[model samples]
Target chain A: DAGVTQSPTHLIKTRGQQVTLRCSPKSGHDTVSWYQQALGQGPQFIFQYYEEEERQRGNFPDRFSGHQFPNYSSELNVNALLLGDSALYLCASSWDRGDEQYFGPGTRLTVT
Target chain B: QKEVEQDPGPLSVPEGAIVSLNCTYSNSAFQYFMWYRQYSRKGPELLMYTYSSGNKEDGRFTAQVDKSSKYISLFIRDSQPSDSATYLCAMRERSGSARQLTFGSGTQLTVLP
Candidate 1:
């Protein structure tokens, strides 16, 4: 089966702009989670979505938001981006909350 | 200090040597432990996972969790150059809809041939 798929392998944006990245979960998966990986740092959880509703959110500000579609696809939106926002954004998918998750290639965003 | 602490080593070792990677966490509430491997410019891939203070082995990879000491480790036996990558430790307090994970800075393992 195809693994989790993310769109626009790379992205570039300027400060104060908005950007949207998309992810499609692996087949037969229902839960999706987003993570941000900064240079030389481990990924930090941004949020999780289940049943098209956001189930959990991390310490990110209001500018970082997400949505899950009925088809198990997800979209991560960042508003008013900062240079610090330049990082790799990863999306993970799992069948249920208790199972291991599968991650996608991630979208590398460079905010200049 | 960070909740999870790890040495971001660009550790180098012989291809056939045994490799040990570790992480320590300050939160005793963490109940599940996992190891993830990531190649450069890629997202991390799950390697092994454990729920209790014990060892779980899969092939040449073994994950050990020591709840009492708030420590966990990943061991790679008969390591290959293919195993050269970054190893990250992750954990969660519990399971459910709120299954958010905390991650540690990855250690870069370089298995030289």
Candidate 2:
């Protein structure tokens, strides 16, 4: 079975610009969650999408948003990127709300 | 203080040596504890998981949780060079719906040949 997959292994964006990262959950998975891992730091929760709607969110601001499609793929959209937004964006998926999540390779976002 | 605290160790040890990694959390509500291993430029891969407290072992990995002390540990026996990676500790509270995980700064472990 294919594991979680993310697009654009790496990306560079300018300040005040927006970027969208894509994710395809592992086969047979239904829920997708996004996380941000800064340099030498563990990942911080961003938000989660289930049933095509946001199920839960972390301490992130409104600029961070996500969507889950019918096929269980997800997209994380960050608007008005800041230098601090430069980090590894990771996508995790689980079969259900309480299941163990599997992560993707992650997209490295650099804000220049 | 942060919810979870872990030593960011660039700890090095010879192959075939036993390695112990640990993390402490201030949140008493967290019931599920997990350890993840991440290689360079890669996302974390789950290594071990324990709920509440006690021990669970799988192959060379043994995970222990002490809810009373709010500390968790992951132990690897006869570690190999391939086991050298950043180990992250993550946990969450019991909930009916999806819950965001709180993680600690990962500890970088290197197993030298």
Candidate 3:
């Protein structure tokens, strides 16, 4: 009955650097989505992965990418990080695009 | 204009008081509405969700949606200190395969003992 879990509670990166954050979806869930929450703001959708392929994406630039594994785990990668990339990266999982989503503790990315 | 709009209220109230939080959206296609409670440095936890338009209640929490007005509300009765957190409103269209949600800026509530 474990819920969604994310790795590396926090991370620090610099400009032109790349980082990868990991997520393990809740048990019995198959779809994984990523979001970015800046300080004092609500989370913005980054992208969603279903069937090991990216199914939907938000207004984010190409620097952001994600992958979903056969086991329903996910990873979010950001390349050429900028100072603005500093934010909380959250991972959410649902079942077959279910109405409800469960989120993980999130990885705090600090771009220095 | 943003798809969803909410007041980022650092609303402070005495314990046992009733608290009300609201959000308005510009998108009529959004059919699924949700309220999430987020503690500092933590991911949001879903509080309530409503499909279409109606009222749903769970314990001290009540959620109301007015589709015609494109507004949604969350009411807390007999609030406690544990209820103090940032409340976020999120919604999504029903027709999408991905069903990505659009979220509000979140309202921060503090229930003083």
Candidate 4:
């Protein structure tokens, strides 16, 4: 069985540009969540998607958005990126009602 | 103050030693606790999960949660070089539908051979 997978292992974007990252949740999972981890810091929650809709969000600004497809894959889009937007973007998957979640390898976004 | 607090330790120890990592939280509503191990530049890998206050052990790793004190801990027995990684403690409220996790700064462990 395949676990959660993410595309574009690494990326480099200029300031004020936009970047899109993709994620495919683990098999048999339905919910997808996004997180941002800065160097030497723990991951901070971005948002969560369930049933193809964003269910909950964190303290991040509106520049960050996400989508969950019917197949349980997810995409995280960041607009007008700043240098602070550079970090490792992680995707986690779990059951809609289950408590535990599994994560993917993550996409490293570098806003230069 | 932040909701969760953890000592970001660059803890170094010799092989075969027991390692203990801990985190404290101010939110009493958080009912699900987790411990994740992350390698450099990698996403977190779930090591253990606990629903409520209690102790759960798996192989060389053990997790403990104390709801009254709002503290959680992860213990590694007979640590090895391969166990060296950043250990993160995460928790979330039980009532939420999305259940987004709040994480600590992570403790970096280096088990020297």
Taken over the whole model, the C-alpha lDDT of each candidate is 0.93, 0.93, 0.95, 0.95
Task: For all candidates, state DockQ relative to the true structure.
Answer: 0.82, 0.84, 0.91, 0.93
Best by lDDT: 3
Q: Can you list the residue pairs that collide in candidate 1? A: none
Please list all clashing residue pairs in model 3, or write none if there are none. Answer: none
**Against the true structure, candidate 1 has what lDDT?**
0.93
Superposed model 1: Cα runs more than 4 Å off? none
Q: Going through the candidates in order, what fraction of the true interface contacts does each contain? A: 0.76, 0.79, 0.83, 0.93
lDDT of candidate 2 over B1-113, digit per residue (tens): 99999999989999999999999999998988889999999999988877868999999999999999999999999999999999999998887488678899999999999
* Tens digit of per-residue lDDT, candidate 3, span B20-103: 999999999999999999999999999998996789999999999999999999999999999999999999998989989999
Q: Write the per-residue lDDT of candidate 1 for residues A1-112, one digit (tens) a residue.
A: 9999999899999999999999999999999999999988999999999999999999999999999998999999999999999999999998874558778999999999
lDDT tens digits, residue span A15-112, model 2:
99999999999999999999999999999999889899998888899999988889989999999999999999999999883558889999999999
Would you estimate the TM-scores of all the predictions?
Answer: 0.98, 0.98, 0.99, 0.98
When summed lDDT is taken over every stretch of 10 residues in candidate 4 chain B, the lowest stretch is: B91-100
lDDT of 1 at A28: 90
TM-score of 2: 0.98
Question: Residue A39: error of model 4 in Å?
Answer: 0.8
Give lDDT tens digits, candidate 4, residues A13-111.
999999999999999999999999999999999999999999999999999998888898999999999999999999999998688899999999999
Model 1, A9: alpha-carbon shift in Å? 0.3
